[model samples]
Target: MDKVNRFIQFNDESVETRKLLLYERIAQALSNTPYMKVTERQLIEYQPKEATLAISVFWRHRTEEVTNLGRLSDIYLLSAGFYRQFDLTAWRTFTTDIKPHSYPKLARQLLMLLEEFRMMESIQKSRAGTQRAFKVRRDIYAEFHRDRLLSNAQRGFLADALINQLYLDIHIGMTSSPHDVFDRLPIDRVRQVAQRIFETETTSQSASLAFQIIALVEEFLTGDIVLPLYTFGEAFEDGKPMKQSSKAMESEEQGESDVKETIEEEFRTWHRETEEEKGMHLEFDLQHGTEGASDASDSKPGNEDAEVQSFGTGRSEGNEKEIGAQPEIEQQQDQSVEPTLQAGSDYGHAHTQVTFKVMEVANKTDTSSLSTLSAWRINHLPIVRALVTEMKKRLERKRQYKRENLTKGRLSSKLTTMLTDERPKPFYRKQAPSPELDAVFGLLVDGSASMIDKLAETKEAVVLFHDVLRELNVTHEIASYYEDTFEASKEQQPNFFEVMHSFDENRVDSGPAIMNFEAHEDNRDGFAIRWMANQLGNRPEHHKFLLVFSDGEPSAFGYDRNGIIDTAEAVWETEKRGISVVHLFLSSQQPTEDQRELFATMFGNKTASSDSVEEFASQTLRILRKLLAIAVQ
Candidate 1:
């Protein structure tokens, strides 16, 4: 049994993990079952038939028949699980009454396919998610069939039409057209007949209807007779029903019982042996070499004395090696500790602040020109909407806390007030101001010359982000920071930070300001982050987030080598003061090892990067979602 268990290998770890997660998502969709008990089921990748995608079976009988049906199989298994939760005794009886074996191979296959469609339709009526899963599976199958197996022939047309009709019937967004080959097939009529037959309220009527459909399809495919496949609701009359022998049934039961008992005995034996070994060790420890004296008569003569001497020699050698390696290990550990960033007196002289009035900045911005950039026109509205929805849900959850008030909630407070006469009138509980209502965001874009190529896409992302935040009514500030190339000197402040949008302005139309953003000079990331953090930290909002957009390493007049460390330290300090900082790396090229390490050091797990401009918005939203999840929790 153990050998057999070992031989039944599952799929790759990652593949199995994904399959399990998919199963969980589908199961959660069907959690509202009201009739038959729904037990949590495991999904194994197995092929019961050559064309079978997936099927459900008892856990104890799981097989290793592998299938390569991809995502379609996942949805099929999910749909099967959904249907299995309902009472299908009538459907099962109707199927069994047909005696599928009595029909031809094509008729049997058609029956099975029609049964699957019927079950799916029934499940879809109650479970909308099931309908979606069916549509996805149908689409996948359609693609595979059309691209690979479909041929321009009569049989191929029939097969394609059958699948196309199924897809059209289940998909809410799909419509029939004259261009479609399946348009000529009376799919609606076929569905109507199937539904009418299945819902006859009697097993005999339902079985008769199913047989009629099967015969009609058979006649359509093969020009032939119009006889029923089998007697409608009667058992097989021509052949004798086979029964299992009593002896065989008893032997099978005994075999299963024997296997169970054998497993139980093995566990007991292992446990008992473990206990005995522990007892022996305890006895030996208490004796402490006095075992020779206590059991002198039972001791083996010279061999026992030789074993003790050998054991002592081996222990001595092992102790010497351990003692010799200790210092080197300790030294290595000391060397591995990361050094902390230290601020020098000259650090404050590297960057100077630059502020601009909203009207002045807006006037200089060419919104129309910026909008014409190719990258700016990339459609990312879907991603923006999804992100906004996620953020709103988090905020809503935060605001839904129970609070104590004197208006309306529980009767207990009112009853207490009545009993104590604490107030002139009875007091009722009501919700108070939620602590999590306040949240502030800071958007910092690196205005270094290196970002010139990425500026268009970066601006687009910032604009979308600004729009989403404004829609959500979140307080946020957008700023661009760069060093002044003309003023850059060892003895003077060279860095300039430009404020495009401030929290106090509550501006929704910041598109002009975002468009005005242009690349200039070098970047002093640490100083800019520290300055941004200072502004965000002063806000009254409990949840403060500062997101930085940068291309690569920071390069300023005197802060190039130490800028990464400085930024990392600044991030740590900001987080220590209850401010969440995330870094978004926008680069058209793949990130180098050093680049990844620098960003990881500064942002930890709060960093996200996009190798292409198109993914910038999505990557930013992904990071935002993670940050919001932690902040809300």
Candidate 2:
């Protein structure tokens, strides 16, 4: 029986990815700004200043259509209703002036609801199709608010009860209060002031009218509001409301600084684009030595072919020569290190603040080692042949179909044409041979000291992967990575990647290099995965896969605590760039619950743990088959 990963989830990542991208597109379209981004939050809100649309988590349990429509309603309110119609500056001024009210919270909630009512009226008038969605919204909110009003009124929470009643009054035209004891309240005065809400056009007018209703009902609204019945999208850029004196001082000090730095706006928030535009991307050439050197401050690096250096036990004399003949600045550095600002700045949580010097080790194994090749072939020949056969079958099936009804091509014979005297439109075309997967693969093997026991199984699995892909003539790269603990520091860490086989070199004799894999000092899984992903990003393939073979989690200098978060972020970033990452855990014993959870957090469901060499090999083949299936489809 084939070994299957028990923790494997059947949910398709591709579909979820596509759905997220589609939601972003929808937000962009609705907001009429390409910069709009959609994220999940506890309540629905749209920050126009930040160009972020947040959908509520409460819609998750609803049906797909209802949930989508609910999100659309929120976006429509914030985009069309408030963003374009409401006057934010005027609203701020009104709030600043009316700071000393008996029931400030109640007054704020009343203004928010009135403004929403105004925007909803405008939205329904302009977009007739949105009326149906709003009706559904009304039906859902009405049921909840009706029950809430009764509960709050019975408990003497008059402020909360009043807001709920007001929401139901305007939303569904329900006039009666839930209880008779609450009939002594000033309902007639509140209704009279609410009548002017439709005639008011701006937010300032809405606020002025809401305060009038608040003044009459101030006696009953003695307590603070527990929860708001409605939400107005976040309009204030500053988190807190500015005091009157601070607002005046800010107005007085506008543009007072002589030194002003301006940042160009972009439609998307990609840091890589900023680097390219600012010419911060560095290019170091290793092939022609110092002759191709670029000035760190002046040269616009051209697109040139330069081989990454090799280090560790696999390092060769040629590699040393390439590493030594660099401009003094480039000798010790294997990868580009970004310059950091000395002054403190808020770089945010997503920044890893780590740099790497990637050096690729050259393969030095002699092809004359027949014993190594014979040993691997003798033990894994059947599995290799089986994988190749199954892959070729899928590839052929994907390529063998034909287009039956073409306007111009070789003539086709049809009896119906003669019997019905139809126009002789009988042409067909053979479907062109589909490209082979249109994908590129990168295999990263961990060479940490902990892998000493599992090295043999890791090699066996890698050899099987190599033999099958080589037989199918697919493009791939295989490398082993480890971090040099002695050279690690706060500024930079040296990472060595030994390439057994690269995309350009698909030699059959490279199997000896695979057998020469060694256990090194430590593993920086995040840095290694990120560096490999950067390599794969440059390839011209639609589908990219990066498979990591490791024995445990990341363990390097000062990286133990935050290594999991960094690795997970790297995986998330790679997948966003259209790369699929899978992790294979090889150990002598089964993984514990904590170990399984750690791997899940880092790789999601794209991971498999194996305790034996045979199981590891089987899991590798299973993952490859699934990936190929996705590619062929």
lDDT of each: 0.53, 0.68
| Candidate 2 overall lDDT versus native | 0.68
Predicted candidate 1 versus true structure: per-residue lDDT over 1-633, tens digit per residue: 001112334631111322333443443344321111112224322111111113222222223322223343344443343224322344344445555434433333334344444555666676565565566555654554344323422444454344334433433223443124434445455555654534543334544554665554543442221322212111212212123334435866787332211212222333333233221111122344443344466865556545343322222335656444345545444543333222222133223222111121341355466555334435666766777777667666656654453454564533565666655344344344343436789998988887888877888788777777776677889988777767756644344555667787675566776788888877777787887887887899878999999887667766654455556656766888989888888887667655565567667778877878788877876776676566666
lDDT of 2 by residue, 513-583 (tens): 78788888888777777778888999997888999998787787777655665577668878888999999
Cα displacement (Å) at residue 24, model 2 = 2.9
User: Best candidate per TM-score, number?
Assistant: 2
Question: What is the clash count for each candidate, in the order shown?
Answer: 0, 3
TM-score of 1: 0.39
- List ranges where model 2 is wrong by over 4 Å: 1-21, 47-51, 60-66, 178-184, 229-377, 385-439, 443-459, 478-501, 508-613, 622-633
